[model samples]
Target: MDANRTLALFERLVEIESPSWHEAEMARACEAELQDLGFTVTFDGSAEQTGSDVGNLIAHRSGNADGAVAFSAHMDTVKPCAGICVMRVEDERGEVLCSGGDTILSADDKAGVTAIFEGIRSMLEAGGPLPDVWVILTTCEEQSLLGSGALKAADVPQGVDCFVLDADGAPGSVVCNAPCHHTMDVAICGKSAHAGVEPEAGVSAIQVAARAIADMQLGRLDGATTANVGVIEGGVATNIVADACSFQAECRSLFPERADEAKRQMTDAVTRACERAGAHADISWTLDYPEVACAEEDAIVRRAKRAIEACGLSFQAVRTGGGADANCLRGLGVNAITLGTGMANFHATTEYIKVQDLLDDARLVEALIAEYAGS
Candidate 1:
């Protein structure tokens, strides 16, 4: 791979401000890059549903081989990512790319995108017959996985496995399992009245929500299960009894049943709180994404292990508590796995990727494609 070209591409992507649900200009930039790489690029039209400015970008390149393999990474980043300036600094792993103290570096998955693109160029330069290569750059991946969830099964290629390059850690680390994520949104309805004039006739929705949250077992429930109340909003004034309160909470577990039980327990807690306060509680539960698991002997795992080793890195199959595009892809009935790209402090202003990690990731991508092509 051309390390300089990969670095330039990564810097260019970082320069673009592509917050979730606002990936129009980023999509166009990637589309033009794909065209330069001789790929047939198309839109999946998922923007109409996900409310993103652009749909997922699907790029394909016909190859001289029989089989096919896919690669994916999201084009969206979380907040505080605008007007990023990529800076090179020294880390233990050598030179690193990061933001310049004001905004996030947006390397959570842009490094993944760069690796995939550089891998294709390297494969072509190696002058071997290539397998059919497909790329899926999704939008709205940060906010509840709206982009990938909107993807239809037909949008992904059939009869092959896709490698999702959007995890944290070393380049060779593969997520063997990812948690099943669930969310709970609640609306607490209570009677409102004057605080001092008719206090007895009023119910405090904030107090109801507070009591519910207090009764719930949040934070880490176990080694695999975790829960949290993320958003809470209500109450009109200090002098008036609040009539309504809305809250958002979430939980995840590597085991599906455990995640379900966590959500259930939270719902029960909300019910108990509402009952005690004489308040009506409305709760909605969503299984955001299903778990991803692969056996050590699974063909996909074995192939990934070989590819990782081929790139002179130790292969590690691990579990993760976070949800990713791999989960949504699995829910779409496609086989997928998440691989790390050495992004550290993601979603924060300190986010960065080692320059060597970028090169290693590109090498890993090339090796994986080579393994699938049997060349």
Candidate 2:
């Protein structure tokens, strides 16, 4: 595969305005590109549910028709800025870099998309091909994996082993473990009264929430678990006792038992705090995504290891609290693993991926395809 060509493709994708739930134009461009490569493409019914102008772009290329290997990536970026202007830069050492200072470069998943595209392109352009390659580019992944969440179980073709190229960190790092998260929103109700006149008559919801927050254990919990409250809102005026308060928080853990324990402890803490403050509090919790922990002996893991080995990179299994589309696939009972693209400073203005690493990722995907096909 041409490294420059792969980088050009990634740059072009980032330049398009494809934020969560608004990926019509980018999806169109990808459709044209895939069709040019002679892949059978379909616009899955995610646009209607997501209220976007387009749905997921699912492309297929069947060659060595035994079992299929699926490559997946999200086509959306996080909020703040879109319609990116990707600039290619070279430092004093002449290493290639790509970015735009004001907005995100969107290498998070765009790199993933480009790698899959390049892998397929390389396979097709060269003589012979691997097993059937199924590609899925999802939407609304930044908005909590909504597109993949709505995907029908039967729609994903059988014999399709899963590979989601949407993790960060180092290129050689393979994410064999990720966490499940629970988001909790709490609203506290209290009675308001004048501070100087009748301080005893009013109950302070802010005070109650404060007490609750202070009492709860937050930040990193153990090695694989963590809990934290990120958003809080309440209080109308300074003089009156704050009657209504609201808070939003989350708990995550790599182990299901640990995650479950964290959830139970958090809920119990919220209830106890509200009861102690003499104010009523409503707590709601939602599981953001399921956890994924593929054992070393699993076939998918073995395949990924062989692929990584074939790419000349050492593979290390690490557990992470960060969730990804892999969580969604794992939830559907599909064994999947998250692969890294060597992106740095993600979700920030300094987001960037080295051009060399980007090309290496593309090559890695190609290697994986060749390995799987040979197997």
Candidate 3:
């Protein structure tokens, strides 16, 4: 892979401000690049559902080999990235890319995108036998994987093993397991009265919510489970008893049963608190995305291990608490795993990626393609 070319592409991508739900410009740029590389590109009709300017970009190219493999990366970035300015600096370690101290570097998935593009370009330039390749650039990944969730099975090619290049770690880290996430919205309704005059006549919803939260076991339920109430809203004034209180919380667990049990416990806590306080509780739960676990013996894992080793790096399978496009793809019966792209401090202003790491990621992608081609 060409290091300079890869860095140039990375710079271009990160400089473009494509926050979640607004990836039209980035998609257009990627589409043009893919088309220039001789891949047929098409945009899906998921924008209306995802509320993005453009849909997912699906690019394909036929190769001389028999089998096919798919690669994916998201085109969206987190907030504070509207006017990104990438700066390349050299430290004792090596060359690193950073932002202008005002926003995130957006290397989380852009580095992945650059790697895939450079890898495919190198393969094509080599003019040798290569397996059929499908590249999917998704949108709204930062917002709970809205783009990938909207993808239909028909949009993906059949019998193609998929891989997502969006993990945050060294190039050789492979994510084999991720937790299932569920979000809960709770509303507590209580009678309102003047706090100083008729305090006994009012049932404080805030009190009910606080009691329920205190009774529940939050933050690290066990090795595989965790819960937290991140957002709360309600109350009118200090002199008046609160009439309604609402809170948004989430729970995650590697095991589905554990997550379900956590939800049940939380619901029970809310019910008990509301009953004791003479209030009514309204709760709703949503499954954000399912868990994904790939065995070491799986073909995708095996190929990825080989490819990582081929790039002169030790391969390590890891479990993550975050959700990615891989979770949705796995739920759709596609064998997929997430691989790191050497992004550090992602979703923050301190985000950065090493130049050598970018090159190594490209090499890993090329090696994976070679493995698929049986070269």
Candidate 4:
């Protein structure tokens, strides 16, 4: 691939702001690029479900080979993505990309996006045997893979092995294990009273929440299980004892049983805290996405390993505490794996990608497609 052309694509995409539920402009740009590459691009009907301005982009191109390979990436970024300005820094190791501004660099998946396109271009221009290539650009992936979860299985072509380019490692890293995400919301009800006049006559819901959180087992409980409370709200003012409190908690694990056990432990902690405070507890749980467990012997995994090795890079399997598009794809029986795109400190202002890493990632993507094509 031409490094300058690929870098231009990345910079152009980074200039466009595409936060979760707002990927309309990004989708348009992707559609145009895909069309220029002789791809038939269409949009899925998942906007209403994901609340995105646009749906997922499905681009396809036929080939002479027997098998098909699909490359996937999300089209959204986290907040503070508007007005991004990318700056190139010269490091001894190589050139490094940074925003050098208040907002994040948005390389979290824009790196993935441009890498796939560049790979396709390079592979297609090689004039070798080719396999059918399908590109699925999803929306709202930052929101627990909401866009992927809303995808219809029929939308993606059947029997097309796939992988997601949305992990945080160098080119050859593969996320073989990913956790199942389960979230719980709790609401505690208590009696209200004036703090100064009758403080003892009422129970503070915030106190109950504090008690429960303190008692809960959280923050990497074991090798594979983890839980945390991320959102909490209660009370109207300081003068009155808080009558109600609500908080959001979540647990994730590579093992389903372990995730379930953690959820139960969290719920029991809240129950005990409410019991001690003489308060009523209302709780609910939602399974955001399922786990991803791809064995080395799996065809897709084997192909990826070989492709990475063929590109002269190290290959290693990893487990992530977070979720990816692969997590949702597994539930659809697609069994897509997650591949690294060298995005460091994603979702933060310090996010960056090494120039060498970007070139290597593109080469690896091209190798992956060629490996599948039997070329």
Q: Which has the greatest lDDT?
A: 1
Q: Give the distance in Å from residue 362's predicted Cα in candidate 4 to where it truly belongs.
A: 1.7
Worst 10 residues of 2 by lDDT: 91-100
Residue 375 of model 4, lDDT score:
37
CA lDDT scores, all candidates in order: 0.91, 0.81, 0.90, 0.90
Candidate 2: segments with Cα more than 4 A from true spot: 44-53, 78-94, 100-104, 127-129, 143-160, 190-204, 235-243, 348-350
* Model 1, span 1-375: residue lDDT tens: 899999999999888999998999999999998898899999998999999999999899998887788999999999898789999998675799989979999888899999999999889989997898999999998987889988988988865688999999899999999998888999999999999899999999999999999989999999999999999999888889999999999999999888888988899999999899899999998877789988889989999999999999989988987889999888877788999999999988888888999999999989988988873
Cα-based TM-score, every candidate: 0.86, 0.84, 0.88, 0.85
Cα RMSD for predicted model 2: 3.3
2 versus 3: better lDDT goes to = 3
Model 1 poorest ten-residue lDDT run: 152-161
lDDT of 4 by residue, 300-328 (tens): 88899999999999988988888888888
Query: How much is the lDDT of residue 15 in candidate 3?
Result: 80
lDDT of 3 by residue, 245-301 (tens): 999999999889999999999999999999999999999999877897778998888
- Model 1 global lDDT (CA atoms, 0 to 1): 0.91
